[model samples]
Target: MIIRSALTRSLIPEFLTGAGRNQREIASALSSSRREFLRNTAGLVLGSTLSGASPFLRGESVRKKRKVIVVTFGGGARDQETFAPEGQENIPHLLNELVPQSSFFTHVSNQGILGHYVATASLTTGVYETLNNFSAVAPEHPTVFEYFRKDLKRPASDAWVVAPSNGFNRIGESECRSYGPGTGATVILPKHLLAAATSGGAADFDHLLRDNYENPLYTPQLGGGEFELQQLDGILRLSVADFMAHARTLSSPDELSIYIAKRLMQQEAPSLLWITMHDIDVAHSGAYSLYIEGIRRTDRLCTELWNAVQANPEYAGNTTLFILPDFGRDSDYDAGGNGFQHHRTGDVASRTTWMMALGAGVREGVIFNDPMQSIDLVPSLGAIMGFSPAQSQGKPIKDLL
Candidate 1:
């Protein structure tokens, strides 16, 4: 399924050919008016691994057919509580179990909005989107998922975004006129889905707390077409009982995401998956102990995710894993903002994070000390998966390519 350079331009769909060519031509020549432009491109819905025996461990030529999983240490974590010398104790699994086996980047900067929704949008799109940080809106540009799906002609199940934040419901898609929902990722927000399933009176304080963190929006139900039903039946059938069990575990959002991730990889072996964890944002409570506990929990969940990848034969030896924080927190004593309480100060601590890449096609035991932008992840992923994200502003990470 890897559409390498050998796939000639003539074979690519008109919507996916050339660098930004599709969007530009459609925007300019297709319609004379704005409303007409949208109507004209309405049909262009971006309509959008694993396993196997021991062929990979046997060093067979299965490298070209790799899958990718991106685990974001989201909700803005600082190095002080996760990766620095003093913070090592809080993430023993990462430092002791995962770091040594991966290629680590010491300095990754996010030079854009520090809010969770906006920051993650920037990360996913490789563009610094300036949208309202708290709104339930999609990015203005096409996501990496859109690029991969449109080019590969993969099913919607092949690209996914497993998030806990309701504000990110649209993160799987975009508002871009050319490539929209038709080619967006299949988004799953665990907490929101659970809330939607739970009866109002039966919901407890824990459920209420989650609801407050991310209020689920209700839309009128619309019957799905035959194609939609066929494509989504399996995911829609996820058991409420199983979801509740995981929701009660340590770091509800993070753990639940990992649990669902395991199931997704097992059932579909998606070509691209993005998982975002948010417990660490509890630091905003300004409680040092709680923040550290969140860090420790995040560390554990990360290890669990890595373990899932290794244990799932569909993903085991032929998957690449990228883990990094969306952004950082203010320095402890900075006059701008208190430590671990704010990421809006634009301080080095708030903007600088780290990245780790492991598994297939990743160089082991290597450390990249040079500074790199956070947006670089999108294109680097493109290079690995064999497609160019036509609208991405960031260049691929040369080392990874």
Candidate 2:
């Protein structure tokens, strides 16, 4: 008899056995084996074909149903600028208009290294980073995505990350990639398609087919056309060939990404979806007037996304939208006059961020006064989605629930 390897055994915990006279010994044994089991179970749990077989795949009863949409206001904006009444007119649409109808967190703050990756990691994983750098690793705890996907037995591809730029390329090992129990596939910035199209590369169906053949995993689904395959390849080139054929009809890259997200929602919308808008970040190249214009465009994008969610049958009435920045720029009070230029040094303004929530299960027009950290988002999201916290460092905001 050939026993399964340790790695294999680690993934499937149901195969383990324990014997003890009392509860403590049994519990200890189970704990030791649990991590290994979950690790070994990844392949089967995240396998594309087996997605529908999971118990949690069954849609929730109408009364218990809820959806979660997390939007990173990538590239930070100051509270004084966005929500604080001091500069309320700067972001009039978001502040005076949106805040009144949605729940606002007046005391909310981000307590990380005051960097993009660090704050985003804290927001999703509910832990502070020891370092404030780009390549920083996400904490080794289950994220809001993992809690919903694994504990709830939802499909692996149900979770989504739609970024206009490379905003969410590092959500986590498990959250960013298709692995482990309840891990879902991610969609990254596929700017390559635009590059290819603009660079005079062939955009015809034949060229895409050839590319697919060279990589068998890229083979298009029966009904999905070549353009769809190209779009899927642009973001996730492996393990998602089934979505390619439908990509042809998308008019633009943004539209293509949103279409794909909507498709995933209809197929089996993972309980958790993260969307990042980065058009404004590109506008910060020393053009003050252009930067303000970018802000307006970002506002419109938010409105468009909200409209899409409302109009889309799959997400309407069932989703919760949480939007906030990843980090903020330097204070204009600096002597060197590096206003709105960078976020290098840690400052009071740089660490400050904002949050807003609307939709199912969230109290409308409520404002939370207690200070909350970005790490708190994961647990709060988990509680709202009917799951227990999974070894997170932050506490859930009871006010949000």
Candidate 3:
């Protein structure tokens, strides 16, 4: 249903009929596969059924109290393990509950480093940041947090991030001129908090304390700007003993993150909240069963977060929730890649992914296959929330606005 330009339409058939598969051909084929799978399995309507953009988009008065929650897939997941016929059984919540209420985009591509930290940094900044994936350096461009805070004249408490690693400490802010410290979101590392709360008695909690599944040899220094141990009592209103006692009941780090995010909603209720789920990154351990387990756990945790949004009066009716992966894992077709183990191959499968947007100001049960990039997220958010991403290399998507 994509209306290609005359020249592009003519060129596509030649590439499709060509002997070797090009990047565009691979991406288009993957998108078409996902589109057909969701349509048949989830009973979603094609976006072509809609007339134009969504009608729920309102004015600044309504947007003043609007909330946005972004959940990212830190580890790569492939179609065969997620949306395909063989993998559909693993994500029952997304297929049966969420996708029917979401505007699904099947052709989102990431044109940046495939590492979790750097890729997520690009997602926040709307720029392809080249900083070391394992380092503690901040992004070179301004983040969406800074724009949302500075332009909207909101305070630090209004924007917050709950990420999975020490590498994300600087992700809440950027070192860009005129938009640096104090003008961004405050990051909360749940594993780091648990480590401090247990105070060297964390041997029983090593499974929940796993950090940066991609690399265990390098631990970055704890940067000072993030949420610290002392503030846990003052901010989240939970004492160290109670927090650790609750942590004893959780199975994964993403669950702990969800627990913290729910408290944040009930306590501070920030207007902008970003949570990165890293459990799926356990694939780097080369255990296929564990990787599948991570996916199922993430699926349940995502629904829990959405339910929390609906249960809270401050966020229930006005919040827009977006769920997508930072990128995808390698394909079994690639000879150089080990299927689903790691994202180091950076193949076409690794670059192509999907996104779902649902809630206020969004169309439901429609699938759009229009090609987009990970960087476009910031501009789309800016347009919806009434801010300007001055240096972003992407444009706002009109379908949501």
lDDT of 3 at 264: 90
In candidate 3, what are the lDDT values of residues 86-112, reduced to their tens digit?
677778888888989999999999999
User: Which candidate has the highest TM-score of all?
Assistant: 3
Candidate 2 structure quality by residue, lDDT tens digits, 1-401: 11246443331122212222243332233323322222232211211112122112223574246678887765665433343333334565554445444665544556567655456656767777553243423345556666676666766555666644333344533434443333643544433333333342336432222221112233221121112334544434423434444445433334444554555555555557787644344324655554455455555456666677888777788878888777666656545436565665554455555577877655555544455677888888776676766667888876665
Window of ten residues with lowest summed lDDT in model 3: 1-10
TM-score per candidate, chains pooled: 0.78, 0.65, 0.94
124-229 per-residue lDDT for model 1 (tens digits):
9999889887676779988999888887677887888887676677788786877886688877766555554454223442532352132234222322111122
The C-alpha local distance difference test score for the whole of candidate 2 amounts to 0.51
User: Which segments of model 1 are wrong by more than 4 Å?
Assistant: 1-64, 201-233, 249-251
Q: By TM-score, how accurate is candidate 2?
A: 0.65
What ranges in model 3 sit over 4 Å off?
1-19
lDDT of 3: 0.87
Error of 3 at 59 (Å): 1.6
CA lDDT, candidate 1, residue 161: 85
The clash count of every prediction, one per candidate, is 8, 18, 0
